[model samples]
Target: MLVLAVDTATPAVTAGVVRLEGDTPKTLASRITVNARAHAEVLTPHILECLTEAGVVPADLDAVVVGCGPGPFTGLRVGMATAAAFGDALGIPVHGVCSLDAIAVEAALGRDLLVVTDARRREVYWARYSGGVRVQGPEVNKPADLEPTPSQAIAGSAGHVDLFDLPVEPVETPSPAGLVAVAAAALGSGAEPAPLVPLYLRRPDAVAIADRKK
Candidate 1:
């Protein structure tokens, strides 16, 4: 199966083409830009470049796997909207996986772990994982508030990972391989996809003019 995966839930605007066979996923091509403000500008070109490098066209994609973020609203909106547009235009199913879970899947070592991403306002979006499966939360809080144990290891946004004292995994963002791995089951089984929902754990930064007047 051929899958197109993209994630804009972190400072990295990532996109890739992956080929899945049996139980594993192999990335054919990928593009990543680490500018926090470039998702809208770089994402589409990244996807097209990935497909081109993979030697496949959009119609060859069997599915689209997207990182539905617990990220800042604007980034999540860009990623999810692009995934939806691709899925709609190509008539393929689009799967939404938690952006943090994608990082967890990449960092899994069959032990307790933590994944966190920048949520700005000096806060982070975090989740605890047991053997790579989400066992605790996809919650947002100030770094010190959720206190992790010394034995636990962590992965995800580099800026925020330093706040926790646990052992760290250098993986600072979601990879295309990790994104597809999170949705491997559904993609393999050909299950119907659920609604694509963005996990903006907090409200948008933008406020209505009327509400601001209050």
Candidate 2:
């Protein structure tokens, strides 16, 4: 199976093509740009480049996987919308995985881990994983509010990972390989993926005019 995966749940705008056979996923090509504001500009080109480098066209994709973020509204929208559009155009299924799960899947297995990503406003998006499966949160909170044990290794954004004082594994951000790996079961089942809902975790920074009058 050929899969196209994308993630903009962090500053990095990531895209890749992966070929899955049996139980393994092999990355064919990928591109990542670390610009918080360039998700819109960089994502499409990255996708095209990834597909071209992988020697396949969009229509060749068997499925699309996307990071449904606990990230900023604007950046998160870019990835999800692109994935949905691609799936629609190609008439393939689109799957959404928690952005944090993508990071967790890349961690060393059989150990407890804490995955954290920048959520702006002095807060972070975090989850606790045991043996690569999320056992706890995909919640957003102030870093200091979520205490990590000495045994739990850390992964995700460098800035937020540093805040916990735990052993850091330097995951940085979600990758196309990670996104597709974590979504493999769904892809294999041949079921229609659920709706691609953004895991904002908190309300958007902007509010409606009706709420401002209070």
Candidate 3:
């Protein structure tokens, strides 16, 4: 199965072309560019370039996989909207994989691991994965603000984290490869595409501004 995967949950905007056969998922072509403020501009071109490089067209894709982010509302929706538009146009199933799960899978950490990402406003988007199972969070806030709990390690940016106390496994950033891997698992489980909804853990900055203005 040929799959088109996209992610813009963090500063990085990533797109990948993967072939999923029996068990293993192989990457044909992938690209990632970090642009904390360019998600809207860069995401589409990256996706197109990836598909072109892979020598596959959108219509040829058996499925589309998107990172359903617990990221900031504005930055996270670019890819989601693109996924929806493509899925609708191509009439193919588009699946959603948790952005944090992708980061956790990339780390390939132990029985307990925390995946975190910058959420702006001095907050972090965090989730816990244990023994390959997501156990806690997708919590958006300062790391020190999270309830004191111990995990095997932590991955992703730790700016808001209490480094001396939290376990340190640091995955750094999310990648298209990890996102594709999670998408493959979802496909294997017979998960089909649905409306690409933005997994915003909190209201958008725009909404906050509008409320304040009123």
Greater-TM-score candidate between 1 and 3: 1
Alpha-carbon error at 203 in model 2, in Å? 1.0
Estimate, for each residue in 3-122, the C-alpha lDDT of model 2 and write its tens digit.
999999899999999998865789999999999999999999999999999999888999999999889998999999999999999999999999999998887656789999999999
lDDT per residue (tens digit) for residues 1-214 in model 3: 8888888888888888888876567888988888879998988888889999999888889888889888887778888888888888998888888898888888886657777788888778888778978888777877567653567677776554444366666566667667777777668777755656777888776766568988
Q: TM-score, each model?
A: 0.97, 0.96, 0.89
RMSD of each: 1.2, 1.2, 2.3
Model 3 weakest 10-residue run by lDDT: 157-166
| TM value for model 2 | 0.96
Clashing pairs for predicted structure model 1, backbone only? none
Question: Model 1, range 89-190, lDDT digits (tens) per residue?
Answer: 999999999988889888867768988898889889999988667987899999889888733798888888888888889888999999999999999898
Q: How many backbone clashes does candidate 3 have?
A: 2
